[model samples]
Target: MKTGEKVVLAYSGGLDTSVIIPWLKEKYDCEIIAVCIDVGQGEETHAIKKKAISSGASKVYVEDVVEEFVTDYIYPTLKAGAIYEGKYLLGTSFARPLMAKKLVEIAHQEGANVIAHGCTGKGNDQVRFEVSIKALDPSIKIIAPWRIWEIKSREEEITYALKKGIPISITKEKIYSVDKNIWHISHEGGNLENPWNEPKPELFDMVTPPEKAPDVAEYVSIEFEKGIPVKINGEELSPVELIKKANEIASIYGVGIADIVENRLVGMKSRGVYETPGGTLLYTAHKELESLVLDKETLRFKDIVAQKYADLVYNGLWFSQLKESLDAFVDETQKVVTGVVKLKLYKGNIIIAGLSSPYSLYNEELATFGEDKIYDQKDAEGFINLFGLPLKMRAYQMKHFVENQKYNKTTVGGEQ
Candidate 1:
């Protein structure tokens, strides 16, 4: 906590981070090393560096982490089928750990023991960032401005920025806090605070409105290898390029938009609108492929794992042992989940058109409605009897007990 010590900050060149650069200098009198981990938010690196330096940062590092994010964070979560609260695709949740890891790496490189972030005390990112940093390096000091700083409310922060002569694009009227990456974009705050308020059309960035989507349904085929999307419409692409292509195609037809009132890790309910164009397509295709290949029991158990995995990611326990174990389970299940799934995208609907896989467990001979050599119709009679034995026995026991009660009542009445 000494003055003039180098402190690495997780910078975004946004309003909160822009203000933090000067505030850190004024309060701690420490040298601020601004590090922006780019996870495909589409930020201009040169502009961010310029702004960071202008705002009193001694040095700047804009680390490009898009490819690592997709292959490491996103694909694993996708393969696990982890959807937070059945709606959030975990766009912001999974991105934070990677960003924090990069921050810690830079902090080590700079020989700084302290790290800072722009995450607020009220939201989930603070937990995500701090926890991941602690997990990575327990010795790094974390400075969370929102928890300790006196300047509260975005309005007050704006005033402080003006007083400090810092450049910020956010205004009081358009104060929606947004988080964007290649996987998804999330919009919170502003009027979205109210659950009943319909999200304004202008708030959406990645997806077209379902009503505004094209009249013609477009068919797209996605091929997967071991549960990771590898191709689109018969064309092979790198992980990053595949996601971009999926986003481009699915966004046009308004594929992935989720408005959710979810339970935050901080014991509060929050409303957020998420746009995950390509992610939606990928998730749908991967699930269909799993259905084609995985057995009923493994698929059912994976659903359980999916919910727990989603909770761990949402609660910022990405480095926890349970999550690592679950990842192993998910990976084992995905070994046979290689296939091509064709889907029809129209007006925000993803309907399965066709599914093909060499590892498919679905057998037409056993499942056929007409004549089938492998399956005997009479076999179901014995199977049903075995499957429903407990129910049948319980029903019979109830019937006999009722008749015995009636007989006992009649005998008692006659004796009276």
Candidate 2:
């Protein structure tokens, strides 16, 4: 690549990305266009722009992608009932593709051949960012400073930043690696790296302590249209808006706190403390809705697909065709899942308040235990007889064969 070619750097106003802007400029002697995709980072974007400029970037592109992040990425996973390995909601996984896409866009716009991110060599973010970039624009030269550069650790990077006179936002004392988005905020590293250590309560941003949650139960209604959340408290919203609204409501109830030890794609178990209060609430409500609308066989079959779907999303195969096909199946099943789920949130528990669906298959009179002429009690006798026909026939044949071994269907030890 040309030495002076423009490059788009994925910039967070944090220590790693802040230091990366100047590092990119000096190492390659190229124009650095810092691209920050706002996936609900919950801060003023302009400040990040200023930070990027001070760190030696020629330009800054802070794109508002919360809507896209929620609708295209978060909502689809919600509809699929995707929880990675039945625990993780994949807060960080969902944001990476959208950010990488934006990076590719800015790189092409700047006529830049190179793109870089602050993802560490040891983490999953590098895989997420690089895979997405290669999938979107394979021609773009990927520069991963963490993988190649001599910055051995975060401490070294901090010292480098100080020596270069670059203003850094992170401190040595508070060094928990964090990724924030509208869906959730995840905390890893530091004390959390050890499974024996309980997550620090102060690490939470979106939730109150479950113990501090309301003593009395709080109720809320969510309306779904074809398995997708469309209305919250009767206010219609886009997918993104619905999740954001849910996030606000659920956070108040101290919902969506997940501390999991999960296996990474690179084959190592890692621990993360996650806060996805809205996602937690949404997941519970949607499953309840499906239980009402779906038949027993369909629900069981969908579960098998759900596992695969979860794997696909977690493994960053969102753009794959298999995921598309599974999504189609999920969408078709969701046609009858249009309804409202009222949930009673008390402490850390989500109790079902009520559920009503337009396509509800509940036949109360038939299911009732009361005596009815239409339902014959003796009918079970014949039904059970038919159901056990094969077993009965085998038993009868064996009984006769055992009794008359010499006249058996086949000679026993040549005795016939």
Candidate 3:
């Protein structure tokens, strides 16, 4: 709260965070260090430093955690096969903890006592940022301006920024809360609030419209080692390059697009349009490879674990003990998940062309219906009887009971 105190802000160079610089300066009268964690925002990070300084930050630090994000956060969620509400790829969910982690690191590096974020009071990100900070460093204080600031809406924030001479890029006409990373781009607010309204063409940046995609189906082959994507079309790539290439290819065919009304952690149903071109492809490839290697029971149980994993990530409990334990189980399943999956991308539909694994459970010899040396036709007789023993006893009991009732029927008056 003192003038000389240092505070590290989770800066995005967006309207909210851009305004937050001066707001913090005026409110707390503290020296602000704007920390922008670049998780593959592409060109969005170009003017971040200049913008932060212009908005009243004493210093700016832009940290690129793209490779760490993909390997640490994205791949773990992918290996667990977690999809929120059966559709959401959790583009915004998983990115929060990693970003918050970086904010804490920067806060410590800057020797700042307080870490600040621009997440609004109504959204899940506030919880995501705060909980993650608490998990890593409990002694560090957090300043959330959205809960304390008098500004009520985006328009109000813009007006406040203009009045304070804080330079910002957002205008009333182009107002949409966007969160972008290596994995996906999420669009919320604006016309997206109305679920019935179709997403405007201009809203689409990462993925094209499905109808506008090429008529010819494009095939892509992905190779996985220990459940992490190792190659694309037989070419090895780094963690960052793999996601980048997959995004490029899948976006061309409009491969990933989901418009859903998801239940937010704030107890409200919020409609969001997500474009996870690369992530969708990777999830499909990884899952297909798992099917080939993992047995039925393990896959089925993993499906249940996947749902819970999704909830933990979505709810911002990524650092919890339960999630760590689930990761252990998920990693055990991925040990044999090394394989290659070929997929056909056509108008946003990912069709599995082929799948193969060294540990594949698909054995043609034992599965053949025709005469096989490994299996005896007569062996099915005893196996079927044993498997259906309960059903056979129940049928016999019902038959005998019906026959006895027919011969010795008792009426309500006790007549037989």
Candidate 4:
């Protein structure tokens, strides 16, 4: 509704968003509130409030939502076993809706009709942020500066910010856009844009490349409660603390570096180098524990079901029923998926060191190759007989038909 005389913009104090603050101010002629949801983008957030005020924002809110981002968004995706296309952990995809939800809440609180973001038209984030806002509150108009504004490239945005004296951290010499939280740090643009180009040392944030990783292997034991990691190395911790602990541990061993040429929700190809050291270890640990406790059918079906789950979250369908239903099913599976998994982090590879669960179905006696009392040999004969009964009957009918045809031919000759 246009009744609201104010507008709230999701601000990162970056080049795009810094320019967008003033642009929205001039275009809408309304009071602009810059809402910066802090989901753990560290040092860059230092002067965001000061910068937003200087850039013509009437007010600024630098809210800390890091714990909620991890517990609510990140952990649930981990619970549902939703890994985007087997490589991506859905880093940027998961962060957007939480950001948008906060934006809508702030907008309503401030009596604002317009909610805005600096997400580019080329990527999936615009769809994610806008769709979520519409799902939550459709009345608010979305002001996307990237889609509507004349200023095209980051270079131009930086130049504009420099000329206008807007405070920003990025310069032309260092051009990688890094999005960081407890979950991951994704590097895009610059050298990563070319699909074949290998990322240089400086492109990475928290991970050492496999080749340069320590020569010795690092071992870790992670404890889980209903598929959510509860502790690292026998020490209990909260969600944020666990991730923080794992990030430190995994980074040292060169864990969780993904370079992918992925298909965007906008129907374009893009390359991004992602470092999610702790998350990579967590996923492996959870899956290892799951493989032991979860039945063959549930695990197999859930693996396939998770693709849809990933798509829903990746495409911003977190508020939908199907995702909730999948969560219900996934939650049921995780009830018995409680335990510890040991992993060997060597260079880039995460080798399964060991896995143990209270409800593990891996019965050594039942699965052993040698003769075992638990599994009677006579059971197989009955099972094979029952299983092959239909095939045996069909074969008998075909043979009998041919034999009767020969007898009939002999009988016809005798009658003639």
User: What is the Å distance of residue 226 in model 3 from its true position?
Assistant: 1.1
The sequence of per-residue lDDT tens digits that candidate 3 reaches over residues 244-341 is 99999999998999998999899999999999999999999998898889899999999999999999999999999999999999999999999899
Per-residue lDDT over 114-203 for candidate 4, one digit per residue giving the tens place of the 0 to 100 score: 888898999888899999999899988888888888998999989988888887788888888888877899999987788888889877
Query: Model 4, residue 269: displacement in angstroms?
Result: 1.6
Candidate 1, 1-416: lDDT as tens digits = 99999999999998899999988998999999999999999999999999999999999999999999999999999999999999999999999999999999999899999999999999999999999999999999999999999988999999999998988899999999999999999999999998889999999899999999999999999999998999999999999999999999999999999999999999999999999999999999999899999989999999999999999999999999999999999999999989899999999999999999999888988888889888878888999999999999999999999999999999999999
Model 2 agreement with the true structure over 10-122: per-residue lDDT tens digits: 88888898888778777888888888899888868888888888888889888998888887888778888888887788889878888888988888788888998898887
Per-candidate clash tally: 0, 0, 0, 0
Estimate the overall C-alpha local distance difference test score of candidate 3: 0.92
lDDT of 2 at 304: 89
Q: Using TM-score as the measure, name the better of candidate 1 and candidate 4.
A: 1
Give the clashing pairs for model 2: none
Clashes of 1: 0
Q: What local lDDT score does residue 230 receive in model 1, on the 0 to 100 scale?
A: 91
Highest lDDT model number: 1
lDDT of 3 at 55: 84
Best of the candidates, TM-score: 1
Q: For each candidate, what is the lDDT?
A: 0.95, 0.86, 0.92, 0.87
